[model samples]
Target: MGRGGPREIVQLTGDRDAISSVTFLADGKTLASGGGGMVWLWDVSYLVKPLSFLCAQVGRSFTQEEWERYVPEGPAYRKIC
Candidate 1:
């Protein structure tokens, strides 16, 4: 998180999982998390827009091999990469 600034309004949590890696979009409204074999996308402006939300999954089930190479543990409260 940016902390104590205009961009500090948003915060992210891994819950019980370990955070591996985090990526922010160019617009700063979107964020991506990767860890425990799963990927998540979040909208930071959820308060103003009900549609804004966070989405998560347990690894990339579509590409088993690629998911294994990227995230081998499955989903976690926090990212590990």
Candidate 2:
């Protein structure tokens, strides 16, 4: 939303973190995740492009034009930055 809610969509799965439970909150925008003695709350909202989100977390931002140079065009991929 324009008000600035969660701005990213992240995929978390049992194969990755061993999630034991999942449920949506009554508001419908929030999700609860549980696994390994931890509970995580997530809010769904408009998301930035994947590359842009990564760049921001590391203290920078990239436009789509900039991202094209570093990302491959197809299934070929690189795992580390």
Give candidates' CA RMSD values in order. 16.5, 10.9
Each prediction's TM-score versus the true structure = 0.37, 0.37
lDDT of 2 at 44: 53
Q: Estimate the overall C-alpha local distance difference test score of candidate 2.
A: 0.57
lDDT of 2 by residue, 1-81 (tens): 543455433575444465788888787767788888888877653232454455556565444555566543422443323
User: Candidate 1 lDDT, tens digit per residue, 1-81?
Assistant: 243335433576664374588888777768888888888888865634321222223332335455466444434233322
Query: How accurate locally is residue 46 in candidate 2, as Cα lDDT from 0 to 100?
Result: 25
Error of 1 at 48 (Å): 10
TM-score of 2: 0.37
lDDT for residue 58 in candidate 1, whole number 0-100:
38
Using lDDT, give the best candidate's number: 2
